[model samples]
Each structure stands twice: as C-alpha cells, then as structure tokens.
Target: MPTYEMGQWLLVMCHRTQQPSPDYLVAAFPTDEIREAYLSIASERAEQEVRHILRAFVGHSRSLGSFDRLQVLSIEALRKEQGREATKNGWSPRFTEYEIRALNHLSGTSSTPTWEGLTWALDLLPHAPQKAIDVIHAYMYAHAQVLPDLRISGLTDAAELIRTRYILQGSASIETLLELILNLDSRDFEYLVAHLYEVLGYDTEVTPAQKDYGKDVIARKINETVFIECKNWQGHVGVKVISDLAGRVSMEQATRGIVIGTSGFTEGPATATEIASRWPSRISLLDGIELIKLMNQHLGSEWHRRVERIIQSERSRQDRRPK
Candidate 1:
C-alpha cells in the first residue's frame, strides 16, 4: 500500500464500477479530477485520523477547534470549571488536566461514526451495516495508536501513554490488550468464545470438549464447531501459545480452533498457518483487535468502565501504602 501525505489517509472501498481506487484520497486532488475519477473518496476522514496526537483532544479540545453535536465551554468558563473559580451556577468543578484529557478521549473524532451511533441505529434497526462496520474498524485499527495532546512536561509512564491512545479513540483492540484485564467472570472464557461466534452472527455454546477437552470453550454455529482457548496474556504469545491451544482443539475433535490472547501474535501468518496445518482442523487466528470486535459486538464500550474500575481499584490498593 502506498502512503499519502500527513493530511490524507486511504479509506479503502471496493466498487463494481469503472475503476480501481488509487493509493489515497486527498484534498490536493482537483475537483475536475474527482468528477473524472471512478473511485469514491473522502479526504476529510483521512485528515481527521491523525489530527489528534492526544486521545483527549480529538473533537472537543478547544485547541483543535469545534466538532458537531458538542458545544465546548469558553476558556474563561473552563478555567472556572477547573476549580480556578466558581461558575454562575455557583458550581466549582474538580476537573484536573488529566480528567480533562480523559473526557476528550471519550468523545468521538470528526467524520467518524462512533458506536454511540451504531447503538442508536441498532435500537431503531436490528442489524448494523456490514461494510460500514468494516470501514469503521479498519479506520479504527489504522489510527488506533494515535495519542491526544496530553501536553505533559515529559514522558514517564509508557503504559498509560499507550492506554490513553485507545481511551480516546474508542479502540476495542487496545482495550482488549495492553491496558487492563477485564471481565474475569471465570465464565469470561465461555462468553468470549461464544461472543466471537456471536460477532460472526452465529449460534454457539460449549461442547463436551469444553468439559473434558483442553479447550475451555466450544462454539457451535450452522453445523460447524469452533473450539477456543483464551488467556489473559500480558505480553507476546508465541508458537508455544499456538501449540497449546492447538492441543486442546485436537483432544476435543473440533472442526476448528481459535487461540485468544490479550497480547500480540509473536509469529507471522505463514508460521501460524503452518502450525494450524499440523492439526486436524484449521486453527483460526485472533489477536487484540479481534477480541475488541468481539467485545463491541457483544459488550460495547461499556465493558471498558469495568476495566477502568479495576484500574481504579488497583490504584486504591497501591494508595494505601505507607509513606
């Protein structure tokens, strides 16, 4: 794939019409060119993708300017709201700079259709548009690591820094890994594997292998079985990772297997395929992104609050330390 300038990103769309899409969409291209061009495009979405370095500054940041549906307070108002003084309503806020950052990350960026919209539409309609979702997730994964303008003096906590990126962008992938382990329901494995199948719009449940099988969860859909092994891996999951999950799938006599982990796949696709080929059924793959999609498909961003609560709880535990 070809890279564009700082202001543009490629939103890949397939069409059955006249021509193939070029490398990217950019405002630099001429209007006459657009009229003659065969591919659909949006330079605006591309520009919005990278405009925010800090997750907290996406749309509502006074610095970057305004976005739709959200009205930001003036600097004087914010200053007072930050507890510098009291508002006209006789209210003084306890909003720290960090919390301000957190607030912005929760809001959506420009030209992006957030899950908030999807949820609304799902309330009105039954199913989400398949293509729109794919496009949304692709854009999400593309810009997933973007940071908001935290505007801090220096970088000290790298984990927090990366976590902040996902926090603002509403990325399920990073939320799945690299931040916090959430929903340790003990039943989470059953739900996660079940939900993975659910995301694919299928019926699923645990099988006998789930009871005596090395696999913790078994999914059934349309006469197919997808056995799953989940681990809350904090770091990279390697060949041994694939092998262990693969073993569990074999014992269960499953048609397929999936190994879910919070970390990244240590081996490349070819190696993964090679390992999967050694087994009876092909083992499918899912890293952090897939896991997040499963969450969004079933749990939504609401799940993050539980993860955040865990963080807060851990922080509280640490805070009880003696000086």
Candidate 2:
C-alpha cells in the first residue's frame, strides 16, 4: 500500500480502537520510537490523517497514545496462519476462508526479510476482515508485554517473529542516535552541523573556532549565503549571541544567518531572531529539537558519511594542535 493509505489505515484503526465497543482491542504495541521513525518518513497525507483524525476522533492529548497497534496485530496474526489448511473443519474454523487466504498470501513463506521487507507485513491491515482482525487482537493481547516470549508461544514462525522483533528494535535506534548527538564534543558537533548543511544542498565551510568572526559555518545555496553560529552549550543561547550573528551577516553581506544551538535558545533569543526577520539580513534560530528533525530527514544515505567526516575532522584538529 502507499504510505498515505497505510498511515490512513493506522489512523482509522486507532480511532476504531478508541471506541468503547471496539471490534478489536489494543493491549501492547511498539513504543513511541517505532511510530516516530515511521512518521518521520511517512507521507504528508499520512501525517495529516493522523493529525486530523486524532484531533477529531479523540483529542490532542490522546494523539500520541494511539500507536500502530492495528498494523502490528494484523501482521503478527497473518504470519501465524501461513501455509496452513483453510478447511472449515479444523481448529473450530474461527476464521473465514477469505481471511485465511488473505493472511496466508500476506505472510509469505520466507526465512528472513530484507530491510524494506520488514515493514511490508503491515500493509495487510487495511482491508482485513473483522474476524481476522479480532483474532489478531486476542493473540496480541495474550502475548502483550512479553513480545520476546512470542518465539516460544508458536503464534508466528520463530524466524519471522525474530525478524519482526529485530526490525522494531532497529526502528528505535533513533533514540541512540539522539543521545550520541547530544554527547558529542564541541568541535565534532560543529563538523556535524556543517555536514548537515552540506547534505541540505549548501556549499559549506567550517570557520576556525578562534577567529570565526562570530560565524562557525558559512553555507551558500546558489546566490544566497547563510552565516551560521553554532553553540554546543548546555545552557540557553542568549539574545546577544543571535545579535552578534546578525551583525556578522550584515558585515559579510550574507543573505541570512542561522543560530544552531544544541541546548536551545531562550525566549529573548527567539524574539531577537524573529525581530531580525524585518531586516535586510534575516536571522533564524534552530533549537536542538528542530536540528534533530532536520538531521532525521536529511541523514538517510549520507548518515555514515557525515559521521565519518565528523570523526575525521575531529582527528585532524587534534593532530594539528601544538603538542
């Protein structure tokens, strides 16, 4: 299914599950990590579906609470009935023939899934019958909070279950990445910032730390040049810092300026940057959260290259320092 449809399907499931008399129950599901990972790359239609449905169906407070439980159940149950006889006589025939066929087809008899294949099973939920959906709901409820135990529960193939687990675990790696970014030293973090600009299609130059003229990175996109001041401080970035960057932009005749702070900017700095918007050389502020969002979006294939560049830059700086 297209990502929008999948996202819409998940939204519908969340809304349906919210009903007091829902046809399916959601016991346990992948935490916020997996959902955020999917949402980061999911289509705008899917994102709007989530926002509109959650606000109209439940409320803003309950938006993030409804994870992709429906998709998870559908995939898990589909895998269990794969390659099995669809006869009405066996196992009390709880599922209809249509459900059986659908599930079996979705759960291909494969050993392991490629990276792209891991999320493929979730595409089965959009058109599944209520009976099949309910069966999955029950099974997942039974296996709730003990997912690793699914390998022994025999609900799904052991290899398939393990693969699913591994995929879900991999989706959660963004948290690790966030932590790593937060803990990076000043110089390494500056290189990362420069690399991020480069990935965003800017021609970037990292200025020397001591005499940077209040700019850490000079990035040019065609005719527009943006002077960037980076701060890896633990405390709030102040208005004076942004003012200095704005002055630098004016001095250098740059088109604009950016203050990228890992700790985030204070209200005063935010207001100052906003006020600078009226001037010829506008200045913008990017807090840690916003920076991370950009990194998550743009660091797809270039992620390893950016990391290597940061490491290499740090090593070069260390090597060049007087011994």
Candidate 3:
C-alpha cells in the first residue's frame, strides 16, 4: 500500500459553465486514504453531500455556487499535468518542480492567482534561486490572454522590474536582445519600456491599454518626469509620432519626452535630432540600436539567447500547424 501526506489529494470544483469562479472552491485532502473513503461515500450519496462537506470545511456563511464538475487529482499528478500544459503552450523557461510547488503554496484557497502572489511565492522558496523569476515570466506569458486582470496591480510592476533585471544579467548581446524585443507585441513592448525605466531607478507606470492619451509609459525620477511612446513597428517612426509625444509632454508639463522605435527614425538620426530641437521641452529619440545600447549599459549581455530560443521554437511550432 502507498502512503500519502497532507494536501496530497487535490480537489477542484468548477461552475457548470466550465469557467472557474470564486464560489467554486479548491480544497485539498490530507491523504489518499481519506480521499478514497470520502469518494466511496460520495459515490453513494447525492451531489448535495459534497456541498455539505464543502460548507463544513469552509463556512456555511459564504454563498456557494452551483458546480457541476469536480476533479480529483493527486498533487504529483497535477504538477505533471501542468508541466505538460505549459510545454504544449510553448512557455519558455518552464517552471521547475520547486517553482510549481511554490505556486501551489501561494495559491492556497484562491482560484485565481495574482502577479504579486507569484512574486512573493518565488521569494519564499528555499535557497531562493533566481531561476524562479523565469517561472514568473513563463506563467505571465502563458496566461496573459486567459487572465487579463492579472497585470492590473502595482505589485506586478515591481515583479516586472525584478524579472527584467534578471534577464539583463544574462550573457546575451545587446543586438540579440534588441531582436528579441522587436519580436514582442506592441503591448508587451510598452510594458518592457516601463520595466526598463524601473531598472534604471525610475518609478514607471504603463498606461492602461485604452485611453492612453498618446503616452504609453510615464517615468518619474526625482523631479524629472518623462513621457514615453513606444513604437514596435517594422517601419521607420515618422515625424507625426514624435510630434504627438512632444504634444503630450507639453500638455502634461513633463520634464522631457522620449520616443522608442524598434525601427530607425524616418530620414535617419539627423532628422530625429532636428525634430527634437523643435519641441519646447527636451525630446530624445531612441532607435533600436540606441535602445539596446542603453539596456546593455546596466546589465549582463547574454539573456536574449534564451528568449531567442523560445521565439524560434514558437515559430517552428507555428510552421508545423496546418493552415
């Protein structure tokens, strides 16, 4: 016979719609024997018995929603399933077993996990390995679409800063990092700029996805407040985009303005310089090369290699898919 420890039996309850809800609970049993005993009785009773058990363990005061499905999984089996799902989703720098354990610990009774919890969980792990930051990145990237509200909290900004610093510590060259950044979507690129500013000792905030008012990021360092616009486009950033940033800077009475373009500015650096000179407040233009240089100045040069590998793998996966 096999033995089981506390929290070995994972119970997951979901609403009838198959969507996870707060009313639906996730509870763990102490051992497999206890779980089996309950299941044997549960199989003979009506579904209401499960609700009674839930209310007994938790509290009857809390309202319970109708859950048509219940899943029983061992913690070990759940970890393996999550690992497979993460790999199938092309998550890079996959979460290690320790990281997964930390995540499970942090989730506790909550059905939804927040970015702050993820960051805190990583810190609490034994030995405090730095690769844990990779776990945060992987989870966020994989669940970004499914959990749109995950990034809403300020704590996530701090986590992003920490993750960015770790990435910067890698040996990837500035050129390679630039290429990797260029591959990011527009929203991610904006968030990356905000994180970079945070690493540079500035307090940064990425504007909401909607109603940004021409500014994608706001960075403040001491008395200096900078308004930034990010362009992840392949084509040159034209005068119009630069002009709009300048307008936002002036309107907000900001200390300065910056336009970060993955592609070079239209008509080259000279044109960008002339455009900035026209603005009332100082305006800095950072092309892809200049942006990478700035990033390399603060951290190690090698992290982009890992990111490149992940990107290439994703591309290969896509290529294999039927059109």
Candidate 4:
C-alpha cells in the first residue's frame, strides 16, 4: 500500500451560472491517484455520471447547485497560492524550490541558515552562483527587518564584498553598465534601484512585490524620504506614470519622487521639462542616459583588477582550511 500526503489534491467545482459565487470545494483527497480513481469509473459510465457521484458524495448537505466544470489542483499549485498569500501579508519571503533546497541543505543541523553557509552550499550546486545570490539579495531586500542577527551580519559582509567587486570589475563603461541593467528582469531592476540608493548613503526598503501602492522602493536619509518607481519598460514611460508617482509621493509624504525609465521618457526632453514645471522639486525623472551618467558619477569609471585579487585571496584562504 502507498501512503499519501494530506491536502495534496483539491476537487473544485465551478458554478459559472451562479453569479458572484466562487468556486466550491467538492472534496479534498490525499493524492491525485485517489481523486482520479474516484472519478474515473463514474466518468467512463457517462458525462453526467461523475456529477451524480459527486452529488451523492456531497449528501445534499452543501448547496453547490449545478457545476459545469471540475478542476483538480495539485499540491504544487496550492503551495504557490499559499506562498503568494504569505508574501502579500508580509509574513515571509517567498523562495523558489531550488532556493529552498539550498537553504535546507545549509541548515541541516541548525534551525537558522547563515549567509556564509548558503554561499558555500551554493558553490557546490550545479546551478550558477548568481541565482542563489539573487535569491539572497531579494530576501534581504524585502525582509530586512526579520532576518536573524547572525545571518544579517554575514549577509551584510557578503553584500559589501559583492558590491565592491561590481564597482571594480562589473563594467568598463556607462554603455556596458546600461546594457547589463537592461538585461535584468523587472524584479531585479527594482532590487538594482534599491541597491543604488543603499550605495548612495540612504537606508532603503523594497516593498512586497504585490500591492506596493505604486512605489517600488522607499529610501530615507536623515530627515529626507524618497519614493522611487522603477519602469523596466522597453518603450518610453509616459506622463501618466509620472502622475501616478506624484500622487503616491503626496500620499506617502515623501520628500521627493524619482522615476527610473530604462527606455527613457516619451517626447524626450519635452516630457522632462513638462514634469519639472508641473511638479518642480517634488518629482525627478531619470531616463536611461541620465541614469547611466548618475551611476558613472557615483560608481566611478576607473577599472581595477581587484576582483581577481579577491578571488585568489579567497581561494588561498579556503585551501588553508582542513579538508
């Protein structure tokens, strides 16, 4: 006999004719095999046979009425929905399956996983190290407040090392840097903006992916607060985007608002001038060209071979450790 996990399969009935009525749960099974076995014979008898069997199982206790469709959701889909709900509630950071596996491998003995341990574990994985790094960066960006103390310190040190490496060896020119920035997905682009603010001496927080209230990042320095909206669009951002940011700025009482558009703003300089005149000091726009310039100014253009030195040093340090 094979054992099955509880709540692994959900039998949902869709009643399309019932206006404003949500999908009703007809039954919950421990496995898809069990659910399929229950419906297969009935389905083979007749199209309406499955419905009759489900109705008999329902025992007239519940009023699902007539359902036109039936859907069986697997455990993976249910877990994804639960994860989304958790993220929306800001209760936990969502991690992909690979990330969770890596973290679990690192936390074999202890309840908490440290950044250094995670890095070591990731080095042993077949996947590229950058994927795990992005996962860590995203987790740190969104859940900075609730991270363990040791993990926080370790992640801070690792982030500093990576940031220094990027500043030194990431790109040689503004054009190359802009190309790399453009290749990042929307979520990573938001993280890039948040990282830039942190580098610029402002404490930053990235809002949860869902329901961010039109702001992607919030930055604060001393008495000033800034709300940033990132648009990783291939086309130019329009006035409506700027208008929405302006509203959020006022609502959040932010000191200023900045929109970073990867493909620049519509109508070129005219749009920038119009926004400046309308919002004055309240809003600022940074197109791709200006964003590159700002990065060059702050991140510098000089290239040093420090990244190689750091790698060599790390290798030597690791080699000295007991095997």
| Candidate closest to the true structure, highest lDDT | 3
Candidate 2 lDDT:
0.52
Task: For residues 97-205, write the lDDT of model 2, one tens digit per residue.
Answer: 3244333444554322111112222222222212222443454465364333422232233122222222222233545555666788777787788777876788777
The alpha-carbon deviation from the true structure for residue 159 of candidate 4, after best TM-score superposition, in angstroms, is 28
Error of 2 at 168 (Å): 14
Model 3 TM-score on a 0 to 1 scale: 0.41
For candidate 1, lDDT tens digit of each residue in 1-323? Answer: 54433222223221112112442323222123332231222211232332221122111223332331132344335655555445456666765343344345444434322212112221211122233334334433543433222311111121122222222233334654445443455344444455445556665544343463456555667667776766666666567767867776666566777877666566656565466556645676677666765554444433555554433443343345353
Query: RMSD of each candidate?
Result: 19.3, 17.7, 22.5, 26.2
Q: Give all TM-scores, in the order shown.
A: 0.38, 0.43, 0.41, 0.40
Worst 10 contiguous positions by lDDT, candidate 3: 63-72
| Model 4, TM vs. native | 0.40
User: Which of 1 and 4 is ahead in lDDT?
Assistant: 4
Query: Which order, best to worst by TM-score?
Result: 2, 3, 4, 1
Best by TM-score: 2
Model 1 weakest 10-residue run by lDDT: 151-160
- How many clashes in each structure? 8, 0, 7, 0
| Predicted candidate 4 versus true structure: per-residue lDDT over 52-144, tens digit per residue | 223323223221111101111222355578789887886664555334433444436434322222333233111222333455577567546
Worst 10 residues of 2 by lDDT: 57-66
lDDT tens digits by residue: candidate 3, 1-323 = 33343222222322223314443322333344655465434423333434333322322221112210111123345667777887899664455433443345444644332223343433322222234444545655664533333232222432333334333322344566666787897876776666567667887777767988988888898899998988987888888887788878888899999989888787755566568767645798888877765554433233344334434543454345454
lDDT of 4: 0.53
List the candidate 4 regions with Cα displacement exceeding 4 Å: 1-171, 268-273, 302-323
Better of 1 and 3 by TM-score: 3
Question: Which residue pairs come into collision in candidate 1?
Answer: 53-147, 53-148, 54-147, 54-148, 54-149, 55-147, 55-148, 105-168
